[model samples]
Target: MNAMTTLTYFFPRRVLRAVVVLLSCVCLAASAAESEAAEQPNIIFILADDLGYGDLSCYGQKNFKTPNLDRMAKEGMRFTQHYAGCTVCAPSRACLLSGQHTGHVHQRANGPIEFRPDPQDISIGRLLKNAGYHTAMIGKSGLACNSQNGNHPAEKGFDHFFGYISHGAAHRYYPQVLWRDGEKVQYPDNHGKEGKHYSTDMFVADAKEYIKEHKDGPFFLHLSLQAPHADLNVPAKWRDPFVGKFKEKPHTKDSHYRNETHPKATFAGMVTNLDDAVGQILDELKEQGIDENTIVMFASDNGPMSEGGWDRNFFNSGGPLKGGKRDMYEGGVRVPMIAWQPGKIAAGETSDHVSAFWDFVPTACEAAGIKPPADTDGLSYLPTLYGKGEQPEHDYLYWEFHERGGKQAVRQGDWKAVRLDFQTDPSRPLELYNLADDLAETKNVAAEHPEIVARMREIMRKAHVDTELFKIPAN
Candidate 1:
């Protein structure tokens, strides 16, 4: 202080003023840098319903055409060993949105857990909203969290909401009514065959409008798209592209090329329509010049059900992984995941660091320079997204889905244990696989590793509280 005062006296008033101004500018720059580092990335989390790990062209499914998704994959990082927390929609959505595992939310399979938590339980959308982000939920939503007024998107921190609460409305490409921020935004009262609307188109339109409106500010869009899910009804404008295909159910087809069959071709059409929607959103982002600042994450709710999906012997739904949809197998849990950020994330990068559904909540928070709420099961993958981290996100992954009805599985490091509910009588046999060696889960090593099974059982025991039903069912 003495030296500074002496220098100020010697330099006179103008010098002192200049020095003060320069120092202030430096401080301001430092503050701005800190803010810039903490600045949010406009996030667009696109989730496809019942979309398989191998469904997209980027994921190596030769049968289906997912050009938009493939393009997005090429622009960013792709994870080969990503998984869904639950095998079905309701629980999976609950886990992903809450940043906790299904156990924490007491949501398992389609309806194992009931009752939505109070709106303050800290969901991703809510966190973003708390951080002053313009949030929206643009598609399928089914959660047992604050949905008494049925958890409409805005109440959950989504400023804009479009789409349906039921998984059925999403299952259809067109519906009679869609919810817009807790209100029933319906379509034509009666469809007389003139000016018929498609659901995919409607979702895309809403997504585009949202983007067009919010590109200037930091925004988060949960574009939960329902495609390749079920019902097998696609409009002619979308379906006309694929007239020949295969069956959704168990049917036999002997065609070297998948397009020749009825079901496969129909499935291809569904995928194409979904891809078109993806293109539309991306285009909107580009048109608005927010493509570079935006970080978009794409994934499916779960693996294909092996029913009403790209169901064919040739179409390896999980593609080299064993199990489909409900089982605690690779095919069922592991699905394709892509993260794209222009000029930030490396293009065409691939990682196998064991990511999961819960990771997104924290990851998005990190991107926004916000901290995750306490009691979250997820860890941020922001460092990994920028290709900086080496350690895997989680050392162990657990699954308790009723999809296999009564299946319990746990994965620690490279080892995994899977026990079917009714394999025998009341006691089902546990099957263990070293996923490092057997991605297909073709061999069971549980008999050889009793100690590991005991240790895993202990892990499950400690994690029991998360699985307990936190709230009773409605009615």
Candidate 2:
């Protein structure tokens, strides 16, 4: 007090009073900044594997109902023009987490062989984790290069990882073994027609536990669910709801994966089961009293698969869009996306926002008040999510698929250009469609609009940067 009074006496009375006020304001600002930092929300991104664009009732499915997903749409924002990273699994997930599109992303296909992400890769997990969010990746990690050598999810910036590292291994719904942070967990019961443990069930259980434990603060959970993909295997209890709902037909084909006795029932059952999983996660958040503060997003890795004895036509899985998986068409790349955040995102809203998986990394970073990597191609839709600030729109979105005779597609405004059979000849002309006029992509009006088509062709060539690993061959 003696020293403070002596120093205060040196200053004039008016100046002394102003200095005291300034000191108080500085203390208050520091406290406010701390409070804001502590309030960063938990972000949960639940990605479904091969669940079609029309799988959910809210997204125009007629045969089956995904009530939980529909409820998510009601509680959140449903994106109509949202697209997956790519047309298939590995590349799509790669494009997603890396915040890079197929053209610039490391992995570009489900592939000639299984691919894994690099340890140094700039992914959503890495970005959010650096921003102080406890990151965990649960369920199918289709981006792994192989079982062992490739960078594990932990190395790729996730604190914890549980599920199959290989996309190929994930095809077996009843996998004999699943990975938990590089350790293999055996499920001996997962051997025969009736496996003791279903992968989805285990995944959901772990997800609930993780949420309950981390309910306090910031966390990034990537729940990449491997449901409704193939094998068409759902527990009898879940399968019972959809039995006899559609025509009974045994799917016995010598395919890559196991065939189902009742493909349609099991297919619908799988989707409904996935819906239940989503509901469970939502319930857990509410129970933890973190519902409003948590940002829960749901989307599929890609569109519906026609393999594994699963019939896309029976389900009309693609909805009104053309083509299914393995193509660059809307059905293959476009997917259903729902973002739910109570007291944050507007309720009962539908956004025709043209967004993709690449946008997720930047979005999460921005929401957490962290700067995204400069090299990323993603644009944060945080403005759109919160309905505040300015939302930056993309001039174009690009994708290239290696399999199914090699395909490439680009979207600029309303014009969508797709070039197929390009592996043999990269110079092939693109099939053009104005998505604004023809959402089905049935009519190719390239002749009428040669200028747009030429621009698109240039974009297709310029957007892609050639890499030895993911090469677009020049014939």
Candidate 3:
């Protein structure tokens, strides 16, 4: 009944209750963090619009500057001979997200597409989402040109979405509005085409905000840049920095004339702007203290459209590869690729192994420690990136693009074959090149190696079966 007796009697039971609650909370917190980390590695797949193999300083372009991209090359693995699925944007992006080569994923060509990503077809976000990683696609979606369709990023299995639904919409950059999580999120800059505003800045700002907010867990950030593409204008401040350094009318490696009004200079400026954007995002990763755990990959969706690709004439965006976009040549599909993940991939290492855009889905899944959805076509390049694996992870990397220039290529080991197939007929004169000996693809060895051509055709048959081309409307 005294004060000391009452206090002593009540204190022990309450102390015991407090100890149990604290221990339980600690266990729950630890469990949540472990579950988060186990979902996979954080991935940032940065796709540059219409970028070329030689645009980056590290790849081969000399006139223009790209300190950030070059710096990434220094810290990560660089693929000397990388490729896109198609010569154009939409198909290339489709193959990339689907993990199927053009032949195995997208059945048709150049877009402004008529159809959306097939619901049946697996997407990178969908595959990763199934395995528990938080997936998103920001910036240019490249899924559809129209706003009303189901081609928005959210429809493709992305948990969070921003940027434009189509590449055409992003041409405005500082457009009137941007879509966030499948709806329009209005912004102040409503410059309605009388004068286009700077968009690369807007894209990077949103991307940085996303990274800042998502640092506590793993994320798949596809910050697909719309810069250096078309309408070729940017913040004049960035352009003025290199007005005199490059010539515009492009100069192609061939007798074909390069488009210059001093186009290369504008292209270079665009490249520089993209580099600055990359710097912003990478800086954020470092600031957030998640740089080491992040797997960041930088690659072009396809080759240059102009003579210099991103730049204009003075610079060669495709380096020593063959033709530019819309062609079946190496320059059309081949691109520069850099994969950076600190404390994982070997620094400054270069690989001649053939890599196409489809590899991204599987590689990201692998880095995140997540398994892709069932029946996925991607094979992870994780071991190769780390320098612990063998050469040629893929038996054959195939493509099918039917636009102004309809073509397809298959690379099996050192042997490569390309076809000039019409919309209905894929069986035609196949161009075979031993890429090991000829990087530019100047000579046709199909006549010399009939056996190799046959093998490539056999590969195409399987690709056709897997792609199910018959389902596509034949119009």
Which candidate leads the pack in lDDT?
2
Off by over 4 Å in 1: 1-38, 112-120, 144-151, 189-195, 245-261, 308-314, 389-392, 422-427, 466-475
Query: Candidate 1 residues 34-117, lDDT tens each?
Result: 676446678999888877887888888886578888888888899887888777788788778888775566566564233344
Using all chains and alpha carbons, the TM-scores for the candidates as numbered come to 0.84, 0.91, 0.84
The C-alpha lDDT values of all candidates are: 0.73, 0.85, 0.73
lDDT of 3 by residue, 1-475 (tens): 9865686687886786787799999999999869767646788889998788788888877776799988998988888878887888877887788777766564345545533554666677876776667887878885554446534566677898877876666666557777778677776656633245456776788888888898876788888987677655566677687777644444334332222344545666778999989888888999999888888888888888863333333466678888887877788888888888888888888987767877777777767666754555667777788777654377777776656435667888888788774445644577899888998888899999998888887776666543444232121
- Candidate 2: tens digits of C-alpha lDDT, residues 1-475: 6866887778777897899899999999999877876789999999999988988999999888899999999999999999999988888988788888989887886643433444456677877888778999998884563556333777778888888887777777788978887788888878734588888888999999999898887899999888888777889988887888778778786556776778888888899899999999999999999999999999998888998778788879999999888879999999999999999999999999899999998998888998888878889998998999888999999999887678989999999999988877776777999999899999999999999988988888888889877777653
The local distance difference test score of model 2 is: 0.85
lDDT at 354 for candidate 2?
Answer: 93
Which runs of model 2 end up more than 4 angstroms from their true locations?
Answer: 1-33, 112-119, 149-151, 253-255
Ten-residue stretch with the least lDDT total in model 1: 466-475
Provide the RMSD of all predictions against the true structure, rounded to 1 decimal.
Answer: 6.7, 3.9, 5.5
